[model samples]
Target: MAARTVSFGIGFRVGGSLSLLALLAACSEPLDLDMRGLMNGGFNTADAARASTAPRPAADNRGVISYPNYQVAVARRGDTLAALAARVGLPADELARYNGVQSGDTLRAGEIIALPRRVSEPSPATGATTTGPIRPSSQIDITTLANDAIERSAPTPAAQRPTPQVGTEPIRHQVERGETAFTISRLYNVSVRSLSEWNSLDSNFSVREGQYLLIPVVTQAPAPREVAPIEPGRGSPTPQPPSASQPLPTETPAAAAATTQAATAAAAAAPPVANVGTQTAASASNAAMAFPVQGSIIREYSKGRNDGIDIAASVGTTVKAAASGQVAAITRNTDGINILVIRHPDNLLTVYTHVDNITVAKGDAVSRGQSIAKVADFEPARVHFEVRKGFDSVDPMTYLR
Candidate 1:
């Protein structure tokens, strides 16, 4: 066969046209490619340089789709707070609070709305009322009984009763507008159970204006002694005596030396009271935490599978705070499961998820074993408990005694 050659870009050639693919393969060397440049829409040298130096958006591993800021969500057409909350499995109130909008407020389409990373599951309806915690007879409908009691106890003539002294005896309180039994109980520093028992009223009974009810006189409990707030993983510093700029009195050299020697001896003999107290406090804080809900652990903590331990429990089981701490957040997962996060000392955080009802609000201070919520079924009727040190998840079993 006669030799034939073809010339193409830069030194490319093919001889004798064995096959177009084979000829090209023989002449072409493997070329190094700038994949990044090609992926950036084949940016030119200048554009590539600019892109390399441009600031990149921050990234997180939360596994949720977020906007550039990661804290705000862009509203789409016909997006209401409630609808959006439902779509994201958050409570409407939390979503509204994040956006600084009222729950009933209308939202403009294409508006930029701030969103909380998570939602809070709405507390469950208690008994026949949604106003307060579930009572013993909450499920019982005593409307007829309350009506009968009202009929039986008609208002007494003013002349027949002596006026009560302001602070001496139980006084008659006139029902105000927009007041419920729960609110009345709180105002009087009494319990709803006590109020219902005293007045023979049912949980569902409505209070009307101009109605007189006997307010029970309760002796207020003594206030708790204030303690320094404990931060996570840190101890309270011992207070030192104040120092004066100018020296006041001078003592004899011998007396001063004697005093110094005595102080040193005392300090050396005495145990480290402050450090002991701190360690004791830390130990107590750790010991105070109990399982939020008692159940068999169905799911163990795994790095990628689950962040917390799942305990299988029945619905309406009381969920207590694992430790003494201020409520950091009460949010919900994307599955519409309620989550309660409490910030405790030692940089520790306890999370209770799949809750049925919440009794404490955000920022409320709760003690260990305090009934803060109730557990309900999420996937298999379980409560999810997570112990975290700052942002890192830790095995709860390690710290949980």
Candidate 2:
């Protein structure tokens, strides 16, 4: 196909960040993306422009071109900022600021990164319009060129660039309110058919908030990155798992006390986990902690915000605790929402918010990676949660060893 070109102004929005469309401009091609930059210290964006020569907008269109809107993409394990940024013709520097990251960050696997929209403006000098990255007919598609550039200059995709063959079984994901099967599948790299069948969803797609489903991991291993935490956006992104298969009977009042004791002990002895750094106090051991969710972390927890890592789980996927702890608070707040708070022996509190239903209760303790509540198993669900030390929230990825 002929190269697509346009003219438009190129100026940063007064306060907001800008974007340059990278790939799959629209639904003609489905996008699978991840944004584990915050949690995994990775960065990747795809763009379609020559670094030195700026191009004009397509002959037909007129507005200034910038970044694309938040769209979907699948993240294979080891994907980095450079690879991702180049896929859609975006520069690494711009994406870093959007996700609160810098260079040398690896994009986390299994998380869905939402890309922002880019606007194109008309440039005055030539009295011509400025175009965003222009797509030209060439040896490689948008995704390949982006990955190549990153490897040459930044080295983000070197570790994990090759895409993996999708697994046979689509992991079951619980449906949360506000999540559609397509969105969940795109984030996890699973097909919509797989998601629908895994959850036994009907043609009409009837689903509750807390139901269980299966989804296979189509990407590589997961990456848990730690960054300087920022406050999570207050606006609840969208409207919004399962049966007790894993086995914990805290729904009843009788099991509360004993469970709490066991959970507290586990928390006290929280093993050390490794992130980009080690734990604060040598006395505290938090190594050997498993990722609560096997998938990638889409959005990480920020204090005075969700205060917990947001795992991009399918409607029926499992959500476990990062560290062992007792079920401290397990109920909804004034908003009529469901949440679970686990109190570890370390006096750290972990919260699982916006869940469909919880399996544990107050006084009941939990082990690391133990299932406490069903995530958005029914709808396109996100595990909204946090880790707090006594009353202060701390990054769980740091202590999750």
* Model 2 C-alpha lDDT per residue in residues 17-112, reported as the tens digit of each score: 323253335433223233233236433211111111111122212212222221233344677766766654567677655545553577555333
Whole-model lDDT per candidate = 0.53, 0.47
TM-score of each: 0.30, 0.29
Which candidate comes out best when scored by TM-score? 1
Model 1 agreement with the true structure over 295-371: per-residue lDDT tens digits = 67777876423657777778888988878898766655444566677878887778777786799987789998899
Which residue pairs in candidate 1 collide?
119-332, 232-346, 232-347, 233-346, 233-347
lDDT of 2 at 312: 58
User: Residue 269 of candidate 2: its Cα lDDT?
Assistant: 100
